[model samples]
Each structure stands twice: as C-alpha cells, then as structure tokens.
Target: MQIPAGPLLQTINSPEDLKKVPKEKLHQVCDELRQYIIDVVSVHGGHFAASLGVVELTVALHYIYNTPYDQLVWDVGHQAYGHKILTGRRDNFISNRKYKGLSGFPKRSESEYDSFGVGHSSTSISAALGMAMAAKYKGETDRKAVAVIGDGAMTAGMAFEALNHAGVADTDMLVILNDNCMSIDPNVGALKEYLTDITTSQTYNKLRDDVWKMLGKLPVGKNFTREMASKLEAGIKGMVTRSSNLFEALNMRYFGPIDGHNITKLVDTLKDLRNIPGPKLLHIVTVKGKGYELAEKDQTKWHAPGLFDKITGEIYKKKFDLPQPPKYQDVFGHTILELAEKNEKVMGITPAMPSGSSLNIMMKAMPHRAIDVGIAEQHAVTLSAGMATQGLKVFCNIYSSFMQRAYDQAVHDAAIQKLPVIFCLDRAGLVGEDGPTHHGAYDVPYFRCIPNMIISAPMNEAELRNLMYTAQLDSTNLPFVIRYPRGEGVMPEWRRPLEEIKLGTGRRLREGKDVAILSFGHPGNFAAAAIRELRAEGIEPAHYDMRFAKPLDEALLHEALLQYEKIITVEDGTVVGGFGSAVAEFMALHGYKNDLKILGIPDRIVEHGTLKELHRECGYDAQAIADAVRQMRKQPVSEMTIPA
Candidate 1:
C-alpha cells in the first residue's frame, strides 16, 4: 500500500502533460495514478471501482484529444476520477469529494477540461451534442466532442433520445459507450442485448470495413461524399449486422466492439477515428471493477468501497456499538418483503437503485416480487401503474432526485388513475458529498402538487416503519410517497409497533407559548435543537412535526396560530413550492395572516458541499433557525412584518 513519491503525479498537472508523455510510458503513469487513487480512496473513500475501470480510457482520451478545446463529457461522472487526476487536479486529488474541495463529478467551474458538468446519469450524449452543434454553428470544424457513457446509463431513455437526436443532427461527435455490463448491477433490457449482439458479431466488422473503404474511395462532391458515404456505409453495415440498426437509423456511424482496457488498441482506434466525419459511436468493452481482484470479483460491493487493505483487498473492519438497525432503505426493503410475504399481490420496483435503495434485499428475500427496471425512471412509474391495474400493491423505491424523471408518469399514470403505489423515496434531503444533482430537495414540492398523492415525511426510523405499514393497510386507493433522508436514522429510545397514524394528522412534539415552529421531514430534528436554543434565550417555541404534506394538519396548524403570535415553518425542500408554501397557502385560504416566516431551500441550484454546510447556507440548520427566531423576537411590535 506504499504510494509512490510525488514526482510522477506532479508531472501530470494537466491533460497537456499527459498528451506530451510518450505512449509507452502510459502504463507506468496509469499504475502511479491507480495507486494514488487507491491510497487516497482507502482513507477518503470515494467511487472506487468506477475510477479503476476507466484508467486506460481516461488516459487514452486525454492523450488523443486536445481537451478544453475538444469536449469530453462523462456520463454519471463518478468514473471521472482518473480524468480529474490527469487534468490539473492531481495535486488536489486527496481532497476529492470532500467539503469545500474538488467535486466527485465533472464540474465546469472546477476546470476548463471538464467542458460540461455532470452528476446524474445519461446526460453526456445530450450535452456533448450541444457542444458539437454549437461548434458547428460557430463554424469551428477542428475541435471534436466526445461522450463517455456507461452501459448502465445507456439504459436511460434520455440517453437514447440524445443518441437519436445526435444521429440526425449530422454533427461530428463521438459517443464511447463504456460497456462494463453493469450500472449498479448488470444492465437490463433489449438494448443491452442489442449492444452485446453488436459486440459479438465478427462478420459485421469485416463487411463494415470493406464497405467503408469502398465508400471512402468513391468521388462524389466533397461535401456530399462524406454524408452519402456515411449513409451508404451505415446501410450496408446494418444489413450485415444482425443486431438492430438503432444508432445507424439515427444517421450516426457505428465503430468498435473494441477492447477498452487495452491502452494501445483504444489509443490507435481513437487516433484513426480522429479524421472521420459525422456522429460516430465506439462501443468499448470494459470491466466494472477492472484491476483489483476483490473489486473484479465483487463489482457491486467495490462500486464504491469503504476503506480497504491494498494487499488482500479486504475492507477495513469496524463493529457497531449497538446492534445497528438496518439502513432506512434496508428497513423499507424488509418491510416490502414482509408485505409481499403476506400478500402475493405486492410488487417491488426500483429505478436502477436496487442496491442503494436496498431493494436488492427484497429481491433476494422475495425474488418473484422484486424488480430492477434499469435506469428508466419514467418507465418504472408507468409500469407500477400498469401493475396496480391488476389490484397489485406496487412499491416503487427511487431516490428523490431521480424521481423527478418520472413526474409525468406520477401524475398521469399513478395519481390520475388513483393507483395504490407506495413510493419509497430514499435520500430525501441534502445528500452529502455527491452534490446538487443527487440532492433530494425537490421531491416534496413535486409530489405535493399531484392530485391523488399523499406525501409523508417520517422523523425517525420507527415512524418510517409505521408509515410504510400504515400505507399498506389503509387501502386508500391512492399513491403514497414516504420520503426519508440518507445515512443513519435517529436512535430514539422509544419503540412502537405498526400503529395506524391518522392519515392527515400531525403530532405535537413540544409545547411552548411565544412562537410555534412547524417542521417537516428530517428538518424536524433541527427545529428541535432550535427550540432548545430558543428556550435558553427565554423564548419558548412550540414545536409541531407535520407528518403529511398534502393533507396538512389544519386543526394542529389552527391551534398553533391561535397560541403563538410568531410562527416559522422549516423543511429541507425548496421554499417556492415546498412545505412552507403549503402552510402559506393554508393560511391564505383561511384568511389567518399572523407573523409567519418560511424557511427551506432557496430558489437556486445549491452546489456541492457538506450537508451541514448546505443546510446552513439554506438557513435550515439549528443555529440559523435559532438566530432567525431571536431576530424576529427583537423586532418592534409596531414594525413586526408578516409575509403575505
């Protein structure tokens, strides 16, 4: 586990330095970079196997293309660590994915080489196409645009849309489909098989090469020749290739089934394709966890490994102080399994987050009841709606941010039809480290507006469990979303069995006189802390935990308004259309306008930072809450302003 001294990585301050290095020395450079990543990640712990898998691809791309000028858009951007190391970030690699440090994803602000910012999946092709189209519009022909997308990301409908659009646009762009046969788990669907068919076809390549050579030799007019040649080449190749001519039909030229790990082959093929025109695709075969034995053997576990020994590749060990309750996601997984166990009609679904959402646990426990529908978020929602038609209870577990992709389906299929689908939304607050694109900030606002949807936020693990149980038994014939935050749940001493919590009722946590603090979701903990601080300052604030967003506790809210002159509503969601806004709407409807303060996420895209930092920035942290209450108390009685 001894890392090499500085000089090797120090020399690679930018992609230019990587380009300057002799190709023969790339293997040594890659070894140094890999070891550096291993050493750094062993302690810091970031996307492990993903970075390992892309070492050669990163090297070859940087070495081949003049980056910053030639765009390199990475899909998902988790595997951009190697690219980061080669592109002026080697010095700060240790600080990667930390608070106030380099981002885990490709950020345009971080470096010029990061041409496009990415965190979510299936955006590279669309973004690269934009860059390509822009380049064409500006009449800049020399520079190229490339998108390095994962096989898992390719399953997303957006990626297909981008591919479809790019093919017809007739712009010169390269899409390197980095096929490791895994997104989180292995990719599914007919497209995966189509890709496999193309990769395995030997005769297709021979026929493609002969046709391409013949097409190149034909002397039509210069401008018309390349277009006509590409069209003819694609047509003949499509006929020879038994696989579906999906990309070719879009008018993009297809290349490769090439070995991605082989540095020489990747570099040589890329160099050859540099002269080719129009949209080109290079389907590269790679291993998800390429180098390390442990990673290679268990790619899923190593996808983002914790601290591990470099030699034996065993993860660093630590025991929990208490018998750790399963992760919130795991609790949901087990609950789903339990529900399915009781009812054969219960179905479990996830949008490519089987492991992250702990749906894999359900899949293992009740394989017949669970399904991972790739990265197709929209598809998962509609599919659940379809399943619900047969009187099945479909529990769809998707991360909060990803759930945005299926908004139309949530409204049209589930909410509109009044389907009994339980949406288990994991990471429903400020998700740490992975940054803004992964933040679960918008789910509350988005799901709240739906007509037949009931949205509930649980304060503790017990409440989460109870909510899920209640949702199952209620037979509401409506869509219910249980939004929960990431990481460890609060260790509350009190325990309760699955009791039916009244559908639209909220419970009071604390009683005080001067002010009322209404909190939603996980932000209730912060409100509690703020209450303690307010008490110390002689301001006793009443605390109410509003469990349901849609069917808000009007009785509890009315009681709070009557008792407290000043009230504040807090949530870990956007202020514009979130919990605070719901309360505001309630007050307006009843014509009860007391001094009200709303606190939540602001109307801007928050950047990558620690959850604590983000919460503080958004004024949802305890200290911020305490300070706001103190400031409100200090305002003169005559000048005390209430928001309309």
Candidate 2:
C-alpha cells in the first residue's frame, strides 16, 4: 500500500524547500508530517510517539533556520524522523530501520543535515557545544548550533556536566528542552518536578509575561537603553522564578515554557533565539505523541508499537498456532519477581528501562522493592552496590549496550568490593533494527578481565532461571552477570522449577567422536540446529554448553580436549576476548594443540538489520555454524596432547 504524503509535505524535499513554503502553511505541514509518520510507521515499523511529538518543532526549525549551515542536534534520535524527512529523505522514509535502509537514529553519515549521530541519550548538549566552539574558533559568527534534548535525557549526569561546561564556555548555542516528561517511560527525578513547577507556576509566568510587555512598551531612548532593558528583564526573571530558574543560574539566558505544538510560536521563538548571544535554553511543553489521540493517551506503549493499524490503532503481532516461547526479557522479568518473593533480600533496579527490560512486572507487584533510576546507568550500579552492603540481593537489569556506561561503577563499586550484585544484561547480542550503538557484543570481553567478576550466559530459559537462582543464593559471593539475547528463547514451556547451577561449570549436551563444538549463551541453540544438520552429513561433532565466560570449566574442557582434536567455539558476542577467546586461552594455557575455529560477531561494526540477517552477515547463524563444521571435516585433525 502506497502511503501518500500530504501535498505540502511532498513539496518539501529539503530544509531549503521548507524555507520556501509560506509561514502560514507550516501548521498544515506539521499536520501532514504527523499523519505521514503514522501512515508509514503503521506499515513499516520504527519508533512512533517521539517523532510525532516533535512534528511542529521539526517543521518550525527547518522553516526558521538555515539548516546544514545552522546545525540542529537532536538528542536520542527518536525524535529525528521528521527532521530526516524534511532534510532530503522523505521518499525513502518507508525504509526506516530496515536492513541496508535508513537508520532509526540521526546519523551524520546518512545526511549533511544530521549535525551529529545520536542513539544514546544526553549527548546532544556536549556534541552541539563542540560544534558551537568549533564555529567560534573558525570565526563563523553567523553559524548557530541548537540542541533539541528531551526532559528524559536531562536526567542523565552527562547532560548536566555539559550544561555546567557550556554555561561557562561562553559559546553561542541554544539548548531546547523538549519537556513532554518522557524518555521511553515517564520522566522521574527532581529535574522532572523542577520543570513541572516552571511549567505550571501561573504566578511566575504572569509576572514574567507582564514584565515582558511592560518592557516592550518602554521607550528605547537614553531613558531606557537596550542594555538597561536586558538587565531589567533578567532581574524580573530571577525575582519571579526565584531559585527555580536553573538555566539562568548557570549563566545561560532562559526562555519559554510555551506550547511546543504551536507552529507559529516555535518559528518566531527560534528566529529570535538565533540572534541571541551566548548560551541560552528554551523550554517547550508538548505531548509525547501529539496529534495522535491513542498515542497521546498512552505514550509508553506507543513509544515503539511496531506495525500498528493507523485507523484502528491495533498493533500487529505474529499469530502463532500455539503458545510461543517467551522473550528472554519477559523470562527475566517474571523470574526476578519470583526470586524477590522467595527471597526478601532481592530488589530490582533498572535505568529508565522498566518496560524494555521487563522490570515493570516486578515494579507493578513490588513497587517498594523495584526502582526505575531514570537513565543513570553509573548511578544504578553504584546504588546496587550500596544496597548489597545491607545484605540485599540486587538484580540490576540493564541493556547490554547500556551497561557500557556503568563499567567503571561495576569495576570499582561492585567487583572491587566483591558485592554480590546480580547484573541481568538484556539485549545481549545482535538486537535487530537498533544497529551498532545498541548491540550487546562487548560485555563478555569487557567483563571477563575484571577481577572477582563471574560472567555467565544461559543457553535457554531454564538455564537463565537457574543462573538467576544460583546468583542469589547465600553461597554466591562475587558480582554475577547473566547476558542473554534480545528476542525469544527456545523453550515454550519455560516455567520450570528453579535449581541452583554450579559455579564455573558446563554440561555436555551431546557426545561425539570426530569434533567438538563449545557454545556460550543462546547461540547454543544455533549450535544445536547446526549439529542436527551436520548429523545427516555423517559429521558427528560433540556439543558442550559452556555457561560461564569468566570462570573456564576446566573439567569440561579436559573432557572435550581428551576426546576430540578438532574444536569449534561459538558465541553471540564479539569473537575477540569473548567466550571463544576464553576457550582458546584455556587451550593455550594447558598446551593443547587442537584445530580450532572461532565463530561469533566479528571485530567490526554490524549495521541495523533483522537478527537472522545480522547473524548470517556476522557468520554465526545455524547455516554458518554448519558450514564451519563441514569445512573442518575436510581438514585433517591435528593430534592433541596434554602438557606434562
């Protein structure tokens, strides 16, 4: 079905073209843009509500500014769909988040208008400040830099750190706070409350507005100079808002708690702010899913409601014939709640990803015990460590890619202290469609080298449950990591009785004579499928599920090594310093000469695509694993000997 854009939207091929449109027609453009987004995303899936919320702002920014020249940096990229469409990507918008198609986020390589690439939150201010500083250094006085950041993004410490620096840097830049009070989930923390007070305070707004009008009416002669007018306005703002004016305190001029959905207001505001000298901020209040009635009501559910019916608002789902296997995240969610019930010590924590990580299951049932720590990964880790000191079992669930931000905290606060914090790493492998920034490829390698860290991966739902059970037991002392993939696990009947898995151990799934295949995590299922395929070819290979990456199961390694001379290691993470590398290091340490092949994500940036596509591209899918086994069968196996 061809979804036609609004007549006005079709005419806008670029920001230059947008500037050509009459200012009176921008509201129509915003409406058309919002409807077009709904039409396209309802068929071709990507992030939904965020872009819808920013439609007016997107149109206004392009219409008012000389973009590409006046750079606009969108924080988190969820709101950049309209920006992309206006800036020469309108026709290809249907390919958003598809394999070899448009990226879901704002990528500099994708277009000149995308001033900076962003996927992770709270980075726009720093990036825009850098651009502003560069422009200043080059004496480009006419160039302007604007960072459009959400209130949810403002919760991160990095955002404040950038604000602290940009305030004193004296660079000419604008930070537009899109405060819809959301970041995938509803915004939390003191900042949310502070922004709320600023938005809702009628007394302050009235005083400020009255003073602005009074100043405008004042004479511009020697009696009331422009500088005098500016000083008067500053004094009134500081007095009216009192200590609540955070941006003013930071030495940046503050403007607005205005309706972001007002196209004309946004256009006028941006035009005026473009000429304002030094640092400044504009606070715009808009609904997250503006213009879409259903999306407006439930912002979180519509955040990325993949492939919905735009008319009926029915989200599409694969109709399974029977009960399907649960997602790894759901299993984690339910399991953590069960663990919390059985053990009073267990508490849950996630950094603004309760829904994504499935911690909302626990948070709903056990509100006091579970916490959503608003986009602060480092703080989440350290907070978990603090709870551990009180003998509480903390399940700090975070996305694999997001965990990178908390590495220092994990090392210093948890690992060094030997705090038994259970880190449930969701989306641990090639998370389809989200692309490079979101892949969970490095956790295995990065955490393996940390002292006292027990890094493990589960082959399926049962193992995941068992691992969770074992990690929370009184016997387990060190920091534990349970990394799993993005989507569904293999077992449909996943609700199994929990059992304690032994630490630093592995189980041989199959016994063979010709070769051995050792796998870590959910990739073990791929290995199983490959083994089934190879069996028909008479290639009898042994299979072992090596559960732990940090603590090598020497007994299992010895058993496999003593029996087979040809070995293959598979994982869902980067091959370098990953599970395969750990196995290789063990072999080298024991002086075992085996013809080995390492198969997993390669040491490179894998782009956005389906899991199957990325897995095949990375050469670790079932077919790839089968091919590796077949290739090894043709070669003569080197004789293996144990070290004296």
RMSD of each: 3.9, 1.3
Candidate 2 has what TM-score? 0.98
Output the worst ten-in-a-row residue range by lDDT, candidate 1.
635-644
Q: Cα deviation of 196 in candidate 2 (Å)?
A: 0.4
Worst 10-residue lDDT window for candidate 2 reads 236-245
- In candidate 2 the C-alpha lDDT for residue 141 amounts to 93
Give lDDT tens digits, candidate 1, residues 83-103.
988887776777787778889
* Cα distance off (Å), candidate 2, residue 467: 0.6
Clashing residue pairs for model 1: none
TM-score of each: 0.91, 0.98
What would you estimate as the lDDT of candidate 1? 0.84
Each prediction's whole-model lDDT (CA): 0.84, 0.92
